[model samples]
Target chain A: MTATTLETDLAGLVAQASEGAVTPAQALAEPHSLGLLGLTSLGFLRLIHAVERRYGVALDLDDDVSYLDTIGSLAAHLRERGV
Target chain B: MPTVAVRGAPGAAAPLTWGQYAIWAAIGRTAPNDHYFNLTRVLTPPDRCRPLDPDTALDRIGTALSRHPALRTRIVPAGTAPGRAPAGTDRSAVPPGSAVQQEIVAEADVAVRTVAAADEATAGSAATDLVEELAATAFDYGTEAPVRVGLVLVDGAVARVVLALCHLATDGHGADILLRDLRLALLGRTGPPPGDPGTVVAEETSAAGRDRSDGVVDTWRDAYRALPPSMFPTPRAEPQPVRWWVGRLTSPALGLAAAALAARHRTSVSSVLLAATAAMVSADGAGDRAAVLTIVGNRFDPSRRDLVATLSQEGLFTLDTSAADFADLLRPAWRESLRAYRSGYYDQLALDAALAQVSAERGEQVHPMCCFNDMRLVDLPPGPAPTAEQVRAARAATVFTWAAPQPLVGCRFCAHVTAAGPALTYQVTGDTRYLPPQRLRAFALGLEELVVAAVAGPAPLAALPARLGGAAA
Candidate 1:
């Protein structure tokens, strides 16, 4: 997927993961820990569900959590995985 | 123990939010458990550069009381208790709500106990005892302050500081904030502490404009009436003392196993854990379908993420382990968990009405007695991370320990799971009468075994070794 499309989809998932505690623009802000923003494991799991459904790719459950710590990194991880 | 001094005047009274109202109701409905009142303890060891002195500690507490409105808040009798709802009433049920109202005292006073311990050991023991006493004793919120301060001194040096609060005043998040602010206050920081997030949330939630449907009162009502209660063994007529038994699996291997299961099942570790818990519960004869109440942090909204308030609420889930395969349960378990988290923020009065409806229909009072809390995000202090081999050996050793005694009010079961690096600690508390020490140990070990087995492979629930479920025993 193109970087632009990936960012949009990943941002949406982060927003959903936060349960609207943070907007997509706010979550995409660099260097903020999603944990502090209220992205709980449940949230991350839900984000996984959304990513799989939208991109039709599976996430390794053991994927390094640092990649999921921010919207930017998660988007990059997905791109690397050819999502 | 003699009270050294009582420090402020009665402040203005405010209405209790639905969240506070629910806690007040639970306190009134259930048998008294002092553990519920113990909010947080801020301990300062001697190693800290600036240890707290008795005078400075009291000063900091005084500052917190004056700065935060909730810290000074207490529950006073409002009008005559709302009349009790008639049987068979659902949403139509009315309240014999407690005759209590939240009033923020303009001035909050704390009851202080100054202990002059003979030595460091004495100081440590005294501090521990004082905290237990403070947490267990029921506070007369209408007359007494919701917060209590205990200062322990060794050789005239501040050895430890304990601050215990009532649930009515602050939730876990708020307690942590109070602790941080107290530390700042010790450093001589001052001002009206951060704005009262509790007030903001209450105002917004209680607003007439907010949507009530999101609370999903009906979903909870249906679950309460339909799901089977978690039947441990026997229903004791009298409340029994409570005890805590903890088991830890501090292995990176367990994490790896959980991740593999989650990946294979296309779910999260939490879902895997929940499904494993259900299998353990069913094998222990708590029935094949265990209805559990999950504690939702309720910090999903960014606005309230840093707000110091009692936003945590209980979401009810009925996990059916009737499926022989543990893997089969993850999908359904995940769905139920999500639904529970979404509906965790229902109106207290509506929940009460639902409880009344279920009670009348069942010809007995029914309550969700089992609680499962995932405290991974609660930000507990981290401990040393064990090596993979150490984690494996620790799991194999399987040692168990009882936490210090706390007052047990009734027959309530709760499991709080905390993770530090690769180590997982499952602290399980239950009324000893219902779940004797042996039974509780078995239950805890059974849970750990399920995780170990799941990590080994995609084992179905019933296909796992009987020893894991304690069934072989």
Candidate 2:
């Protein structure tokens, strides 16, 4: 997936997780923890599952939180994984 | 003043459900601090823009007590013949036919302790201290009321109300119902009538036959035998006296992620979190096989859904974390959660006897190392959907979380997860000696990361630095 597509999908998941507290445009415009945007632990897990299913990439990154801090970084990481 | 005793409400007397009996049994066997109890705190500015007077406060509490039968009920030990003394304090003193009973009081004197504090914070702290003190003191199920209330005054105005209940009287959900109704009564509104316990008891009694079938008990027995002895890493020794180190993990991301996964899997968000917990514990090398005691809110019976009573029970769920891939385990985790819920409401005494039998056969005690309670479903009324201005205001407001010092019980570790708005808050308490503070905090962080990775993709799960059986890290 292209960076744009990855960002779009990540934004949708973030918005869904946040219950529309943060929008797709807002999520892509900045770098912050999705946690700050109201994405719950369960919601984040679901987002991971959604991203994996969409790109067919399995994220084995346990015990790590740096990549999940922001949408930009998450997209960058997914790009590195060739999602 | 001394507490005033009263009789139960007419027509509300009934047998204790299996769940209550299990907790009652545990309380009877354990130390003074071992009982399963809940403390709730509500802070309000004032009533109708004026200070809440003592009489008004009593009136509100009295109205609430009158509405909820569970709040006014006392435990009557089984099979002592009506109006006779309950079979003694010891478990063995009670005979086989002696089931726990609930006798609701038609009217009773409410114990309202008035504490004077300088401010809201001090008031809340005082109330919390009282809750801790009350929790350590065992309840006299044979005579005294199972519920108590504390009112804190700030600058001569009622500001904080704390309601503490023994798990025998009500579960968290029931407590919430009581509080909601109490709030309404305080506002001078008549809340809904007490939920029909008579109908609930009848339905449960009817279903008791199917619940006793051999197939159900045998399935649970097999599951218990298959479970790992303990799925948590503790210093190798007999379990020590319970001590608690509580911490909170707040994240909005986790709530949404779990919701999405739950939707995709067609399961509840709780199942998703539990699966994640099992995976996290296993990945940390707590155990290759995860055996957890999950608290199931047995409100699935529609008739009892709104009743204020103890409808929560602990159900065992075991999982194999040996899978190299985390995604491969979600389906099985969800399935096992269903099985656990289905077999949740069996007789506590019979189940304990069966567990002892299984433990003997296995040549070791088989108890879950961890306990998980999901309180997300017991939500308060939601605030109106946020407008842009409201969202900005919320963002601008300083965010702070204050957690009361809580005591731990039953097991070495217990994790209670609740939702605050879109964010998820985890209240974890455990014995720090067994689970060192640093390591426990690390495990909590790992749980968060594990969920991130579980959905991140099919990457190999990371192994913790040190296994429990290996040398101390």
Candidate 3:
């Protein structure tokens, strides 16, 4: 899968993980959402798991999921880590 | 009384392992004014299943509880001389746990009191017969610190399970784990099979095996000590009312929405849920000044995996929503959540004390003047999932009963998120006169909506769009 599709699909999954209907584009555009930078610990795990599945790679122990503290960070990390 | 046992049949000073201790310490930090996390539930024919023989089931439960050290442990500060009575105390509490010997259960770690025929409809007009039977059944259950296993038989079947643990012993997750284990024991299932996550790891055995990790209890103290002791959930109410409610989102859509929100916010379903709940609670004029209580399980510590361990700390985050726009409120809410994350270390004692004092003068529940607990956050893997109907019925019948009235301040809501689905249950008990049953349910529902709307949009737009449930409305 192209890096763009991976980000798109993975970002889509994170959006689904939340409750309201949120477009990934608006989420990307919003700063208020920055606070949501931290999901519940378990949700955090699932997000990581989703990224792993989308790209067909276990999160590199080196990738540091916690470092994806923000949506921007998560997308960038996924881009670099998406095999 | 030789501490060691002669042979088998339950005995050991199995201390709380790193994971168990971490969790209990966490529980001790986030508990309410009273040492009661009284999470009682009415077991249906399904829940009541145990060895056909009642005696066998009791023994089995006893034996099962006996195996876990955390269940037997209690929390006493780390250096306090055992039984030497710390200041203003006469109890020689053996730390946060106590051992269980199979001697008719002098005290139950958790009592399983039975009240046969509590299934309401089937249990018609049998109050006289049932009450008489319950009185007889009650005798079989112990009433000491660690409650003995007490299961009631209604019309010949196991009915209500009363698990009253010293709040210091278990948290919501621990209670769930204990119940599932009890289910296994009743079935032909042998002791936790290898890899049964519920199987108590050696490290988690408490000092007597309850959750006697008093030292671990101080994690939140340090976490909160770092913060300014600010009053929270402003306009704190006293005689804090408490109530319990059970509600399930009832749609695969909720799960999907969660995934979508998570992807958009770059957070988890829980954050979405919490942010939503927080918004709902704050929606009324109440959101303008109140700070809801949240207990974040800080199993973040690497050495622990008792994710089931109920250890959690209290976070008294101040959410100032007096901003001009939706984003204004959302950004600060986000910042507050992040601050809470940074100071996730919770102190149950502090939380309880804060609630106690908060309730002492105001008219609101202190611990969570209104809780927005997300149980799905725990992540129970999907097994043969129960039908939504079964899960819903079980939750509906049991949620209201979990409320331990009076002496508690706020009404608390916990959302247990399972892969099968998310179940939201609230436990409230305070003043029945002030907040009646109808009002309690209404408050819970309102609170649920507020949290979601808040997280879905920004300032001046706290409400979700019409397409998304009209959050603004």
Candidate 4:
């Protein structure tokens, strides 16, 4: 899949896993707010694993995901790698 | 033979050992966002009328080990098999490596073996000795080492077993399944074929892989990496391995009640547990100040099956019980817990390394010597019982992992409760030098009392230790 497609899929996954019962897309978009997305330090981890599987590439979570919280950040992340 | 499945999401960076980093980096030939920490132990009946046969035990452990492929961790590469690194987009790709993929024993060089001890006390002592020796292979970082076998002598007859695994390969629930298989194996029951569930996996992991922006943890690594030389000081002596101490507390029904309380409190069982621990830390560390670290398990994903890697991060919650109006601390704690997940910034291992480096540069203690862990939620996936290993009346048995790590703290609080289990189990490990066993019990009871009290009605604070003192002893 193109990096862009992969990014969109990941956005959907993160939004779906929103812990606070918020809309998946919103959770993907504004994960920084409290109560909007009940994502925990633990939830971030599970998402990484899921995305890695869907994309089929080794993701340096330390290098990438740690900085990408919102979908915009994630898209920017993909853009940086020429995704 | 036993079958183990890990169900959790992996994060950006969890508190991983160097051993873990090296292994993943070596295999993928690039960094991958997958790591797991697991604890496994084997127990025998309380007494032994029969001296457990080593061959039988080895067979049991081996059969149990056979079910899990160390190489079960497959990475779908970004492109063709072993082609050029897929540009930056598919920067890395791979087929399972010999070390990490296609095997249950991640590294046979360091995996564990069973040794029959002379007796119970000997077995107990031997377990540590073996751990210490085996630990020498990878001292600092906890890896996905194979099933480490230790003996638990029950009545000088049947040798109970202990399987101390690196967190990468197993978890509390998986460990329970392994133990059940071992117990059945002891009675001569064989499990399903090796790799039967995730059996038909594509042997050659496709190189065409995914983007790497999934974030559950935010390590302050880059910020630290960018820090001036002055912020990263040189270490004098390597961290001296101090005598590790451990303690235990049984929160029978207490933990579940706390979970219910958490539901009322509008948080998770883990969050409430952390809040109570925050109170305990604030109370204990003199000046009502403390730094607390909690494990955040990311097993929410349903697609990827290998949940065993060190796929977690640390959630840092600083409780300044010193804050005026102790009750108000709840709002901030709740907010922090809620935001921690949302912020996706608290990377477990990277941030820890960064903080440690920064602390050392400033010459402060690198770690918050004591920590609290509340593994109260279980991620056991329901499976149709294979008609193969049907043994009834066999209550699902589980090994207390936090129990084994107790010896390492001045005071450690471990609280875990399974949905199916009846009790809220806590293991408190400590030494006399830090505090007497009784006093540790007091601290645990005090914490439980505190949690229960808060759950009851946020009433006047009561002395937890004094209330539950006699029961722990």
Candidate 5:
């Protein structure tokens, strides 16, 4: 997938995970951080599940979680993992 | 104790669900004191509702049992049929073996003990004693239903209802749901039908279930590898005669400060409290990174929201407490807490296998053992941040007391947070060898002081040991 398409797909998952609390546009905009963008603890778990389901790659937060700082960083990490 | 016969819609026999298996394993580990897992609740009808007579109370209890199949469910050895426990064989003596199955009975008798009191105060006292008696009694999983009911009659009217529920039947959240349904039943109303336990069993054993369980085990393996073998590896003091001690701290200031911090950090109150606990554990010289097994209520799924079953499980939460300011830990704590909660739902057997594998690899057991449970059903929302003076004044009402020591406990450090009226109560039950009675008091009080101090400004992590009076150091 192209960069834009990948981000758009991720944004859709983020929106769904947030239970519509954070819009797809807001997610794509790359706000301060997911936590600041109003993604709840349960929403974050749902996002992890959604990402794992979509990418077939489990997200390990115990590892270096700097990727979780923002959407752009998360997208970059996924790309490095051959997403 | 008078027996009340209750008949409900019977459910088919099925293998225990993943959640049930987890609690069942704990029950076995706990053994004779398996009653430790009993959840007790004393409920009274609201003033708006009419007083209940003995017959009406019995009818309500029956309605509740019929609505929630879990209340009438009984567990037996894997292959044994519901009512056909091999004739004359002692069902209670049956070992859990590798698996146990649960069967819902159409007719089961519940022990209903009644206490008559002259007034509400007398009734309350009688209810408390009855609740303690019922709660301390272990449930015979094979032969008895999962619930014991007690009614306290004030002037011949049922004024209070006490229920001692087996943890195998329901968790804290599930218990709340049961209480709500029971209240509705008392008012001659019916709530939505609860989720079927058999469906839970089927879903848990399906292909999707296996995959989910596998994923959770994989997560556990990775976490076990990353975390220290044990949070309390070295004993700081000799074990007391009792071996385990419990300390409880009730602080209105801690509640106020925690709410303020949670609001400021834009996270849940649980995360704020967890961050402080990680800080304290780290200060106690455990390590720069603190790992705690946080109890997770696995009720995120909409379908399982109202399911009166044991779905709560522990999730591993590892946090780096090497930050300069305590506030810096809240965001990461929240994030890792979410991860832990996600990892809580899995096959307990598979999780054990994974732990064994990791322990073998590491040449030691890989269990954090330290636990944190926030038992509040709904967190107190962040109100206006309390001023430092306000928090300090509220601190005068803080109470720290040592509870009865236990001969056996499940963990070295088991911390729980619950709302107590206008205060937040923190209870820590620790192995006496690791946390002496004095240190236990310090730990509980330290939690309150740390949170209350943070309300004024950013609390320095380096100053934590001194603030805790070097109890952690």
Candidate 6:
């Protein structure tokens, strides 16, 4: 998928995972930190599950979790995994 | 005793969901005293709400049961796989074979025992007794539904409704949902029913589900290998007559101090309490590394959020308390807590196999028989930090006492944090052989002192043992 499309999809997933508490615009604007966008621990887990379901790629939570600190980093990691 | 017949839409038999399997394993371990797993709630309608007649209450309960199939579900041995068990077979005595499945019945009879009381005050006392009586017996999982309902009638109207639910049917969160639904049903409100358990079973059996279980097993293996052989390695005192004793510390000061620490550190109150407990565990000579089996409510998925099922499982939480100050431990505790909760959802059989493998590798059993359960549904944002004087004043109202003795639990050290009116209550039930009543009392007090001390200023980690009245580190 294209970069823009992937990010758009990711934003939607983030919004859904947060139960609409984090809007797509807010997710896009706060690309550096999803936590800053008000995503809770449960919401983070849901977002990971959504990403796995969408791309058939599992995010290794035990590894360095820095990539998960931001939407941009997560999108890059997914693409590097050939998503 | 009178029985109320509840009829619901029946579901085909399927393998027990992962959540059900987890509780099933615990039930097996807890056996005859399995009633300990029963979740009981005595709910009295608010005074503003209309008083409900016994017949109306029963009707509302039946409606609620019909809406949630999990309330009508039963676990049976695999021998009775395709259908219900034979009418007269002893369901509890039947040993489960290689597999077990849960079945939802179209209709089941629930016992409704009514206790007549003269006034509301009398009814309140009767309700408490009814809860104990209704929850004291284990459910026959193979034949009987997993719910018992009791009504306390005062002046020909229902004053309180008591529900005793088997752990196989639901956990604390699910019980809350069921109670909410019951209230709504009583008020004649209607909405779409919660998700079904069969769907959960199907999802759990899928390929992705297997992969998730594999990942969880891997996490468990790593945690087991790192944890000490046991959290409580040595017995400090002789075993009590009851083998276990429960100690409770009810303190508004602890709650205020913990909230202050949580706010200052930008962490959660659960993490603050966990850090304090770990400090005590380390000071008590368990080791610098504290391992606790934390209960995880696996309702992150929206689909399972309101599902009335036992979706809770244990997750491994380990913390290294080599830090210089107590404040430094909060962030790591919060991060590790998140990881532990994430690893909680998995197949119990797979986890068992993993534990066996780890135990064999270590040449001994590898289990952290210490647990921590934060029972609050939501951790509201903490207000501004309370001043030291305010916290000290609140400390004057703290109460620490020994509750009733309990039968042997599965764990040696179990700590539970629950809300008690305006204050917070910490109950530490431990094996007396490992933790004597004195030590249990110290542990509870130390939990309060640690947080309160931290709120006042930086509490030195090394001084915790001395402050807690334990041997110096």
Which is the leading candidate under TM-score?
Answer: 6
Q: Give per-residue CA lDDT, model 2, range A1-83, as digits (tens).
A: 77688788899877865556668887787554454444544355556556766777765432343576578888888888866
B1-473, model 2: which lDDT tens digit per residue? 32323335555457777667767766654545544464454645345734786567666667776776676666665654554545346433432234567766565565666677888667777877766555556566666567777777777777767667777778887887777777776777776666775565565567544465344567668878887676665563333243456667775555555554444443445767788778766764565678778887766533455678887788777777778775666666766765565556666666778889999999999887688888775221222222323323333322223344435466767788888777677666666666665666665655654554444455254453342223332
- How high is the CA lDDT of each candidate model? 0.61, 0.63, 0.41, 0.42, 0.79, 0.80
Candidate 4 C-alpha error for residue A29, in Å: 26
Query: Which of the two, 1 or 6, has more DockQ?
Result: 6
Q: Compared with the true structure, what per-residue lDDT tens digits does model 5 show for residues A45-79?
A: 66777788789997877655657656787789899
Q: Which one wins by lDDT: 1 or 2?
A: 2
Docking quality category of candidate 2 according to DockQ thresholds: incorrect
**Candidate 5 versus the native: TM-score?**
0.86
**Which stretches of model 4 miss by more than 4 angstroms?**
A1-83, B1-38, B42-64, B71-145, B148-168, B173-245, B286-289, B304-306, B320-331, B338-353, B360-363, B377-421, B431-439, B460-473
Best by DockQ: 6
Please write out the lDDT profile of model 4 over residues A1-83, one tens digit for every residue.
Answer: 46556556766777555443445556555644312245433454455556556655444532223243555565565556555
- Which has the higher TM-score value, candidate number 2 or candidate number 4? 2
lDDT of 3 by residue, B1-473 (tens): 10111122222323343333443443334333324344432333254453244656666666556544444443334443443323334333332233211111112233344445555565433433333333221111112333334455555655434344443345665556566766666664654431222334343443432242333234333433332222222232232334333433333333444444454444545555555444444443343543555565544332333333445554444455555443344434444554454343423344446445545545543343444445454322222223334333343332223332434333433433344544434333323333334444444444433333333443342442222222221
Worst 10 residues of 5 chain B by lDDT: B85-94
Candidate 1 chain B, run of 10 with poorest lDDT: B85-94
List fnat, each candidate.
0.04, 0.00, 0.09, 0.11, 0.21, 0.19
DockQ of each: 0.11, 0.03, 0.10, 0.08, 0.21, 0.25
Model 6 clash pairs are none
RMSD of each: 8.1, 10.9, 11.1, 14.1, 4.4, 3.4
Candidate 5 local lDDT, B1-473, one digit each (tens): 67767677787778777778888887777676677778998888766565777887787778776678788787766787656654334545455433677788787788798888889878788888899989887787877888999999887888998999989889999999999888888888888868876777777789999998898889788878988788766677889998889889988888878876766666667878888888888877778889998888887665777799888888888898989988888878877887778878898888988899999999988777799999985553423555678788898999988887777777889998889986888999999898778877887787787788887887888887775556454
Tell me how far the alpha carbon of residue B232 in candidate 4 is from the true structure, in angstroms, after superposition: 25
Q: Give the number of colliding residue pairs in candidate 6.
A: 0
* Poorly placed runs, candidate 2 (over 4 Å): A1-83, B1-8, B11-14, B43-51, B86-100, B119-136, B198-201, B207-215, B233-244, B260-267, B284-287, B378-408, B432-434, B465-473
Residue-level error in angstroms, candidate 5, position A78: 13
Instruction: Identify the runs in model 5 with alpha carbons over 4 angstroms from their true place.
Output: A1-83, B81-83, B87-92, B96-98, B380-382, B387-389, B466-473
**Candidates ranked, most accurate by TM-score first:** 6, 5, 1, 2, 3, 4
